[model samples]
Target: MVKKKPTNKDDNLVAQNRKARHDYRVLQTYEAGIALTGTEIKSVRASRVNLKDGFAQIRDGQATLMNVHISEYEQGNQFNHDPLRNRKLLLHKQEIKRLAKETDKKGVTIVPLKMYLKKGFAKVLIGVAEGKHEYDKRETMKKRDQEREISRVLKHY
Candidate 1:
């Protein structure tokens, strides 16, 4: 008899870029597999990953993730991988072309919203986003505050 693996959503989440939604208006999101070295995978599983300041790009018909940091494994000596190296994202050709087209627009770029492990493999949720102006950000904050106030009032009833 084989033991079944427990499925927990939060447990699988490795890292998230909290500021991604605040700074940019995400238009679309794509789930792409990431290619990580042995040590890098080990570091990711240990929750030593940072998605802040990370972005994705399509170049030469390939999707690449950049600026994401996966801390070096403490147990890994000379074979440890570089933390800041650009890692390839495994996406379909159609998806790559779509992302490339979307990024070609002004003020539009690709950002990594979060990184998680799925089926024991590292996956990144990348978004095509446009920069949010100061006023837009303020509006979003105002709306959120209003919603919170409404919920609080309802709960008191």
Candidate 2:
């Protein structure tokens, strides 16, 4: 019997924005550390985060994550953080400059794809994306269905 070494890619995944892929064509991805308060970090560790309506923006030479919700910790009481506060994303100045330039293009934006814990710190995977048209989305769905059918048929052989 052979054992496979576990991959750490998603071992600590806290939240994911599945809709981001469907709505946008990702051009590039960057891993960034996120700033979180004590209660916010606790809530994130509990997997109480949402990336559905989240987006990232580069402002004043810094990257900020906006509209993401990290639910308040149940036991935080008076120290609980706001669920929808904008949080800073830790990225190098060069990366932030590049992202800012990329987003200057029409229809291109930065979005949070996933959040996970790395080395005891919270991290976010942000993507540079261009919005997909309706027809593009339909085509992608059709192609996915075709691939699924092909795999199913091959498995039966």
Candidate 3:
């Protein structure tokens, strides 16, 4: 039988913060629109962005994305955006209110897990996560290792 090698995501993936998944137990996920400048758009098209260490904050009934890194556009001199800027996250007032209410619970957070261009518009996938205890994290790792081991066995047999 012919076997096909496993493949990762396409190279067009802009940025991902894997740690967010490990450190927090994601309860729900939301796709949010981001406001970007021209230079920021160019930088995103080049895949020059980072979602690591990025998070969403709720303030004054609004949502803001903090610590997202968008590299400077090479062709745009003196008009590039700040690499790490707090940008507005576009969501309905009701959604924002819901997120804010949920986030008020201790140890629950708004984490930006991914950034990518979807259907010609930039989007951020934010996770509403609750902090995981050390034991929980270890259990997750153990389960992942078991899955990997099972996959390896199946591949060999």
Kindly give the stretch of ten consecutive residues in candidate 2 with the minimal lDDT sum: 4-13
**Mind giving the per-residue lDDT tens digits that candidate 3 earns over 14-127?**
788888999999999998999999999989888898888888999998899998888889999988888898999999988999999999999999999888777678888899
Winner by lDDT:
2
Q: lDDT tens digits, residues 23-57, model 1?
A: 99999999999989999999999999999999988
- Clashes in each model (backbone N, CA, C under 3 Å)? 0, 0, 0
| Candidate 2 segments whose C-alpha is farther than 4 A from its true place | 1-7
Q: What's the ranking of the predictions by lDDT, best on top?
A: 2, 1, 3
Candidate 2: the clashing residue pairs are none
lDDT of 2: 0.95
Error of 1 at 32 (Å): 0.5
Residue 43 alpha-carbon offset, candidate 2, angstroms: 0.4
lDDT of 2 at 72: 89
lDDT of 2 by residue, 1-157 (tens): 9997775959999999999999999999999999889999999999999999999988899999999999989999999999999999999989999999999999999999999998799999999999999999999999999999999999999
